[model samples]
Target chain A: MHELGIVFEIQKRLLAFAAGNGLSPASIASVVVEVGEASTVIPKYLLECWPAAMDGTDMEDATLEVEVIVAQVQCKKCGTVYPYLEHDKICPSCGAWECRMVTGQEFNIKEILVYEEDVPEDGSLGGDPAVR
Target chain B: MVKVYEIKQRVLANNDSEADALRSELKQERKFLLNLMSSPGSGKTSVLMKTIALLKDDLKIGVMEADIDSAVDAQTIATTGAKVVQLHTGGMCHLDAGMTRQGLEALDTDGLDLAILENVGNLVCPAEFDTGAVKNAMILSVPEGDDKPLKYPLMFTICSVLLINKIDVLPYFDFDLDLCIGRVKELNPDITVIPVSAKTGEGIDEWAAWLKNEVTAWRDTSSSETIIAKNKEYDK
Candidate 1:
């Protein structure tokens, strides 16, 4: 349910971003979102809801690209930071139980891909002026 | 040609900022807000009711019960004579910071000592969003098994306190309290895990007293002097 909610939120931001950047909505090719390993958003569910979330929006045809962020935990007592899934929050070096997450909770719109603007070939360079 | 612009913005940025505002506002008012999370059927509502029933007389308490549907829990809290409100999430599984702030605003906190936000019962997603409460707690019942910390480690990691509810059923269930504690403490060394049974009131006093202590500590730390100091920073 939160995935769909996130989808809708992304749609709003993408649309506003498109407008604010003075870019046409048609130029947007894909919206890349990073799904952290421990984040609430389920990428598969978010993609499932994307079509519905984008319905009638300017980004209706924009595909969503998901990037996964691996969870990393930093042990407070020993100052060891490591992948959480690997160590399960225990510092391998010091065996400390107190760890705070430094990453893997992020849910972010990582990037937006758009069609590059077509360059007009008729534009003359400094050496290709009318005199040339 | 295709161009990629790196946005690198948090998907829940709106909620995050709103949560910050709510956190500061609650602090300024010298009130304590607790966000309680648990899996459905973990007795979240029952624990809340018991806490409110035991603490309402000593503290000006308010509660916000959020469910996808039904006002049943709200009805239960109302009987305790505390200010209560029920929020229907319209099928939303979680309540974000903005939604929580709205609920608190509606609960009439003008002289309230403490407020509890009983989040929708779902262990996974609710732990992901910061609801801007001063303290966060979760309930794990004996029937849910001790493997939860290993299975859903994120929830165990995020909570400040863990309530192992339905302890009265410990005799019936094959729950090993030591194994559960060991697992959770491994994940969160600083967590305060309180074993309680809301049904039999076995540890309700301890739970209520913990809440009172937290509330008092929060209030005492953010006295008028601290607010003035904060105001000075704003002015500067």
Candidate 2:
């Protein structure tokens, strides 16, 4: 439900980043994003919201790459860390309910892949210098 | 040739910063904004009516009701004679800091001591985005079951106060109050849990007292840093 808003936010940031770097929106190859398993942001929903967010932005052809981070929780009682979903919010090692989430609630933009045209070594702005 | 830009930034960072800025702005205006969230049919409107009845005489209160599409909540809250505004999220499930700011502006909260933003009824999306409120609260009615904390950990974790509403119906339902509070505490150690029945007015005094104290304390404090620091302490 919230994925549409998130996609718009990502698109806004991408626009600003592209502007700052002097890159065209079409030059962007793929946008990489990392989401934690516990972040409540479903990667599937983000993917579904991507096309609508990119529509009319001139970057609809660009791809969205989503990377999910597994959720881990650290037991406060026995100082043991384990995967959260595997143990059901309990310390797997100590069998205790007291535990702190160490990781998983993360939503970040990792990087952007852009295709830059190769320029000739003679300082001339040429189209595909290697092809010539 | 492909060039990579290693921009490792949080997707919600922009919203977070905007929330912080709105917090500071509200602090400067001496308005204590409270973002109330819950699932649908959680008696949020009923609780708001009761709360307004209790504290409206003591403080200048304004309410901004956010819904995907509805003016019903605004109409209900208008009966209390307090300032009220209805905000349509335009099909969005949650209200971000920007939308909250726009709502506040529409309400014209100049000298109000408390501005309550009744967020859209959804446990997931609202908790993920901060509405720039001084505090976050959610209501979990007995009929909603006690295992909600396990299902919606982020919602349980982000809330500063958890109001276990519909206590009057506890005799009919199989909800375990102790186990529910325990589960919530496991997720958030510092959360204040209050069991209230908005219908019979049970525990409304304590909830109203808490809000009154928060509003008064916020006005007494001169520095915005103190408020931010205090909020940050429980928000973690």
Candidate 3:
């Protein structure tokens, strides 16, 4: 499935980001990915593939968080915005099918929650990383 | 301590950049790459056969048939005597920029003028990923109904052209060609919709002409900067 490939892509980016930020791969506490309701990706599929993607990595213990964006559109005729599929792509105000997608097509990495404490790889904890 | 870093980057940024890079590389090589996408049984192979037959006489054509499994399409394309490569997606539903680049490398595009990538027989996922093609086109058969544009808006929006295949069966199927084109145009103002019957070789000349014009434009562009600028303007 493409979700597995997507998970691998996420893992690659996370590793690169971790390296660039001087954070241990294991220091990544969680990853938050924003998926659009109308985007090609399925949130459930991403969730299903996350664990397998992290199985052998240092971020194995890390968790994945998916933020969904509601699919909405702005009617070009009446300047009205409404839920896309909920309204069956018809503008409520003008009953127009021509509109611009305002949201729900985004697939982004919104943020990453990391443990600030530099836990050693040798299993010795210098200080307890506060979980917030 | 716990911290939250606001990355706010697109998950597909990596693939997009790679695709852009590949596009530039193809431009430098003076090759016109076309990415053809459609659902299964949309007459994609039949359209490709007609397209190749029409253009192979004038252009050095190569076809890359991508599927999750099997080389049946590739074998079919080989009968046309054009350079063909079968790209197994390793069970993935679509081909990404990296996979497309690998196929191009394997195809050895030294003497090719037009390289067509027949993407996996899928409508949803293939539209999500860019395969480094100069232009994206998809076929929508008459039997698939006229409301496909409504169901798959992204595919309609991103495609440069739409080929309405199986038009020969228009009398049997209650497909309103005008309505379908109108719906697609509403989503994509610039999409060129052509009705054709791959089985009857109708309207293939127009499709071939479009490809020939694209190949000529891609090759006649003198400098890389001009090509990039033109491409950017065209994309807009």
Candidate 4:
């Protein structure tokens, strides 16, 4: 499935991101991703492939967090904004045929949740990183 | 220790940039790339074969058939005497812009004025991907019914040309052509719809003439700056 291919691409990029941040892959608790509603990506398939793609890798136990961005379209003639699928391009208000897509079609890594230990101002050997 | 990192990076940034780069390369090479996407059994090969027959004398043509398995389509296209190559997606449903680049490299593009990528058959995935083509064209056969535009609006939305294939079967199939074209135009304000049938060779000349015009126009404006002109529509 294409989603599996996309999963591998995301995983590869995530590993690079983790390395750039000087953090071990295991330090990532979850990788949050935002997928557009109109993007042809099936979230269910992506979730199904995530664990399989991460197996035996540094992110083996990491969770895959998904966020769906809704598709929005604005009518160029009527200046009305609505769901892209609802009206596509024809404005529901003025019956115009021109519109601009404002959102959706996005696929990106939004954030990375990491597990880390906090150190005290004195550089204590045993300070819980969670304890700011 | 735990902290969150905000790395808001596009997952397909590599694909977008690669597609842009490929666009520039195609312009520099004087190649007019056209990606054809349609559902399986939509006569994409038939249309392309007919196109080859019609334009072989006037234009140098090359084709790349993308499929998950088998080289049947590529073999069929090869019979037309045009330079052709087959691309295997290794189970991927769609060919991303990166994959299309690999296919271009494999095909003999030297002195070819028109190169067409018969993209994987599935309508949904192909529309979501950009193959760095100067123009995007898709085919919708009459047998598929007119309701397809409602179901697969994204395909109709992104395509600049919608080839309504199998018009010969219009009487056999209950297809409303006007309704279909109207729905498609609503999604894409600037789409040119051509009704044709590869079986009867009806409307093939018009399609060929359209291709000739587009090909020469692409070559005339071949430049790195105008390579991504279509994308500039969104930048506004």
Which candidate number maximizes TM-score?
3
- Candidate 3 per-residue lDDT over residues A40-124, each given as its tens digit: 8899989999998899889999999999999999998999999988998799988988888888989999888888675444534
Q: After superposition, which runs of candidate 4 have C-alpha atoms over 4 Å from their true positions?
A: A72-102, A117-132, B222-227, B232-236
Question: Candidate 2 local accuracy as lDDT?
Answer: 0.87
lDDT accuracy of residue B199 in candidate 4: 94
True contacts kept of each: 0.68, 0.71, 0.71, 0.70
Question: What residue runs in model 3 are displaced by over 4 Å at the alpha carbon?
Answer: A119-132, B223-236
Query: Which prediction has the highest DockQ against the true structure?
Result: 3
- Local accuracy of candidate 2 as per-residue lDDT tens digits, A53-100: 898776888889999999998888899999988888778777986777
Docking class of 2: acceptable
Relative to the real complex, the DockQ score for model 3 comes to 0.46
How badly does each model clash, as a count of residue pairs? 0, 0, 0, 6
For candidate 2, write residues B1-236 as lDDT tens digits: 76667777889888888999999988878889999999999999999999999998899999999999979999999999999999999999999999999999999998799999999999898888888999899999999999999788778877778999999999999999999999999888888999999999999999999889988887778987866765654233
Residue B145 of model 1: what lDDT?
A: 98
Residue-wise C-alpha lDDT for candidate 1, range B1-236, written one tens digit per residue: 66666777887776666776787888888888999999999999899888888888889998999999999999998988889999989999998887898898888888999999999999887776777787788999999998899778778877778999999989899899999999899877778889999999888888899889989888888454443332222111
DockQ for the candidates, in order: 0.36, 0.45, 0.46, 0.43
| Structure candidate 2, residue pairs in collision | none
Per-residue CA lDDT of candidate 1, range A34-112, in tens? 8878676778898899998788866788899899899898887888888977886678889876677778877888888
Candidate 3, residue A75: how far the Cα is off, in Å: 1.4
Which is superior by TM-score, 1 or 4? Answer: 4
Calculate candidate 1's fnat. Answer: 0.68
After superposition, which runs of candidate 1 have C-alpha atoms over 4 Å from their true positions?
A19-26, A70-105, A116-132, B223-236
Q: What is the lDDT for B104 in model 1?
A: 88
